[model samples]
Target: MPNNSLNYHNCKCNIDVMHLQSQDIPLVARLYKRSFQNHFLGHMGHKFLTLFISEFVNSDANSGYVAKYRNEVIGFVLATTSDNPFREFYRDNFMTLVYLTISRFFKDSFIRSHITKRLGHVHVALKALFSFSVRVRDSREKQEICLSRQPRLLALAVDRSYRGLGVANELTAEFCREMKELGFKKVGLSALPWNQRAISFYIKDGWEKEEASETSISFSRLL
Candidate 1:
């Protein structure tokens, strides 16, 4: 059941924020696919997208939250509280990853566009692995300040119809409150450079830009 219900901007309707559960994966996957229609994960197909969201929920149920309106899930936030999230994710879901790779390689589209994107994922994973290793070798100071004990907001999406009703704000505020109770000094998140709406939302919510690059911008806030 949802933890509690909240009014959206003094509206008559209420939104419920709760811990994400296994049963909500399908609905969340569909919402994610719709929210990020042009993104790579959306293009990975519904089955793969479901599996992707499942990993986050399975990894740390306490760190994930869902927003429901009228008993229907309308948005979700998936995050990792582990210090080494990538390594932990690979370790926990290695078998699934292998199966998906093999199946996609053989049964998926053989067209150049699809094949290229699939290969691109492999290249990106390898590069990220190498980058992680290097960061581990370097001092903690050199690593992204946001990668500490604080939880990282990995993915967040809301149904288009519910975008401006303060669902995102409530979800984030609740997560930060939980993190503070767990003794975290700060919480962090990142967004693509082009996601100006997300960036503005974070800024207005008291998060400060901690780092930036051509590809992404990282933000953190004291909890």
Candidate 2:
């Protein structure tokens, strides 16, 4: 039911999707927490979320778009042109993210359990960070292949109050347009199978379901 009348050529649309900026991170972070309460990143606290979102502004590998309706940030979409956005963020902000993660883990039992459950991922990330230089050439080779095939959509969310108003559609279109402008021929994303609303929206918005595994349903769209 999302409205798809984004007039990128003019100012006639109901909401405007603008390139995300530093000042937009705070609002976008709060929206992320509200929208993703069940996700591990949501449990990482507001300060952590703020720092994480700052990467979208501060890093070159990752970028995002924010939607505004009458000056309020109603939604946002995040996308990465390269494969190692998380690794890049971890490499750049290691000590800070470590401090934040440890602080949250001790203070919140939920995070402790979550972290414990994902220790294998932590090990791989740590290994990747330490071996970055040794593997950069090979990693970049694979990244080039992946980048040429499809840049991934990292996250997309809309303000619940503004659903079905074309904000998600416009934000998605902006993401695709930006990626295509970046020389990518396709854009890809995934959704939790239980998130029927999001899955339906992606399909209705023109993404083709490409794969379905236990954890997520992947979708891709050509420019």
Compared with the true structure, all predictions reach lDDT values of: 0.72, 0.80
| Model 1 per-residue lDDT tens digits across residues 1-223 | 2333433555224777888888998998998878876565665566777767776665532267898887789889888776555554444455666676566556544422456545765555554445544344444553344345678888888777777678888788778887777567888889999998889888988899999999889999988
- What would the per-residue lDDT of candidate 2 be over residues 1-223, giving only the tens digit for each residue? 2234333343235577888899999999999999987778888899888878887885567888998877788899988776666776677677777888889988987797778667775776686678644345676775576566567888899887777666788889888888877678888898999999999899999999999998899999999
- Model 1 weakest lDDT span, ten residues long: 3-12
Q: Which candidate is the best by TM-score?
A: 2
In terms of lDDT, model 1 sits at: 0.72
Clashing pairs in 2: none
